[model samples]
Target: MKLSRDIMRFFIIPVVLLVGIIVTAAFTVFYTTTARTSSGKIISSNWPKEFTHDFSEYINIMNGTPTISDTGKNLLVKNDLWIQILDATGKEVCNYDKPSTVSDTYQPYELLNLYQYGVGQYSVFVSSVNAGDTAYSYLIGFPLSISKVVTYVDTDRYNSGKTLIIMIIILTILLILALTVFYNVVISKSYERIRESLGSIASRTYKPVAGHRFLREIYEGLDTLNHDIALADRQREKDTKAREEWLANITHDLKTPLAPIRGYAELLSETNTDIPFERSRKYGAIILKNTLYAEQLVNDLKLTYQLQSNMLPLKKETLNVTRFVKEVVIDILNAPDLEGRNVSFISNSEAATYFFDPLLFRRAVTNIVVNALAHNDTSTEVSISLDADSGVKLTIADNGNGMTPQELDDLFTRYFRGTSTEIKAEGSGLGMAIAKQIVEAHDGVICAESMQGVGTTITIVLP
Candidate 1:
């Protein structure tokens, strides 16, 4: 509502001023356009000439004299005017209701000034009056209502200054109206497009606004906002789906181990069957293996979130980097699933030392190696190599089922599970992500390179 009020103010202020100017002009023209008589008859600008024309009918000569009829005198009386009739040589021949100030004869320029402004205290009109074959003329005068203005003028300036000013005022009004209309059209169309764009955004069907002159910066900002919102929505949807898959995978992993652990315990609890000692031991081993797998799954979940929240405790200490890494690989291969897999570890410089959380770092390495073994065919070879740069570079490369570009891109996304159908893999789908978090927590960098048909290489550079 506040924004709407501000917008209304912006538009209305200018328009209000425009309207005010028009109203003031209208009143100005209304009042200044003409005068009224004492008898309350409207005496417009054309009245003087019209009265003179109509008075001609009541005028002629009577008995070799230029005389005006009583009706003609009445016309002059109604307007409060005086009159004189002039002969061929511009000499006043007869007069009616004549004022004392007017001359009996006029020079050519005096006659011009009388017609243009009037002689001092009166305003006058002169027109030829045909009186029989004598060809005399008539003069009419009005008493000045205001001080007469004598303007410097020429042939070009001979038009009535009052009429010219009025015409100019009218033209100015029309021009202002034309321009105002044009301005309104431009603003209205831009507003319509802006409104449409906002509506589309609200409905989740947004499109970019087109370029325009008015409010172009605003349009560009909206376009940027539209792009950002679209990106954020897509990322959110992708994250949501990935999280759902992660949850499903975690549930399956928990169930996979539980089923075996429960079955073995039930078998050992049977009293009827004389279970052989070796068989019982084998059952216990299988149960322990499943329990360990389930425990590891839970640990991965706990640690990943801890890393995300910056709550993971890192007990940093100096250790034999090569031996520690090798021990991690050995422990991973010891798993029943990874036993006897073709795995190798190489290091050119084995005496390097680094400070890190050994327990958490071991978990990081195990996750990477186990992931490679669990997903690949038995014929594939895995290699773990450690090298010295400024500190250490540990790489786990595999001639196994390498991932697609999209899979590789999302490899370290916390909830992203592999899309492989080659093996029904176990564990909580967060292995790679957990590995990344642990390495990063140790102030290390981890990245991967892979080709789908050739191989996959996971590299960790630690300081």
Candidate 2:
């Protein structure tokens, strides 16, 4: 059912062959029949000329046949001539007896010497007898024994057969050549259209191919595929736009905290007093905290860039899930910002093993947990758990002011913060993007589920 190029070639050749064969057969039959009919007419036309001079001699020889002796009969039979005579009653009269080897059905009367001896050959004649009340007939036969009329007939038949074969062969070759040229011209145009569409896609011009100009179903199918590719190109462009906007927002957010820190530090350096010293120390501490926050943002951005460019090299090894979770929790708790946040671990197993890049996987999990803590209103209880279903599932559920549908739609995009959220307090939006990159690099998936006024749950399934 699949009409591939090779199959089409196979069918096309046979169709051409069948057409050639039918046409050849018809022409051959017509030619042969016409030739035979014309040859018969030519032979019949010259019959009278060959026989006119032979008839009188044949009749004179048979005059004494009724009383002929055995020796005379032998002489008559030795002449190699065929003769027959009939009586007044229209039946056979005395005549030379043919040899036993002669076939009874031989029609000597129809034979003709269309070729004479050393020039033409066999002669034929027909004679009638006039009886009182009955009519009788005589027939005579002889041969020239020299001419090549038989050879001429044989040659004509041979040439006719040859001509028929040659014409058929020539026609078949021409048909095949014509079909080849037609397919190349038509199919090549379709291929050119496909190549042009691919070039447009490579140049980032996402546009559907025009389908109306196509004449074949194959071309229509190719156009459909082109449309799908165009849709994917458009989607990628939309994602890139969203990423650029998010990155701009993150730059602004990073600059916002740095401005106050720099201003306060400049003021503190101008004087030294108890009140001034305390205020200066506070500003200095705030600057250090915000600087560390900026450093984390830069690190997340670097990781995202490496993942996007396919430059991140992973050192895969088997990791204990329970131990990995514990280490991540300890690290998060030790963070200066989350020192007073409430976190809990709920696990039924002490050992759950999975294969992944330890450094990247740790960064992914850390980002999710930190994101949950940063978004919560007050002292939030975050739960981390792992299950055994051929993978490690990390669930970081939070009791926080959750996100809306539109916010969740752009949740994992780079530097995207939810609506109704403070951009200053929400850390660099690159955390979730970096987490997504790391998870995907490890051949895993991460998803978020949230409802407004309730909470958010971030689930990571690592293989």
Judging by TM-score against the true structure, name the best candidate: 1
Clashes of each: 0, 10
Q: Candidate 1 — which residues are off by over 4 angstroms?
A: 1-6, 12-196, 213-217, 267-279, 334-340, 419-421
Worst 10 residues of 1 by lDDT: 1-10
Clash-forming residue pairs, model 2: 112-122, 113-122, 113-123, 115-120, 115-121, 116-120, 116-121, 117-144, 118-146, 121-144
lDDT of 1 by residue, 74-173 (tens): 8788778888988778889899879787889977787887788776666787777675677877878876453334567775556667688889988987
Q: Residue by residue across 125-208, what tens digits does model 2's lDDT show?
A: 445544344444554444322222444457777878998989988897787777866765565566666666667657756366
State the C-alpha lDDT per candidate. 0.81, 0.66
Q: Could you tell me which 10 consecutive residues in candidate 2 have the lowest summed lDDT?
A: 110-119
- Candidate 2 local Cα displacement, residue 253, angstroms: 2.2
Cα deviation at 112, candidate 2, in Å, is 35
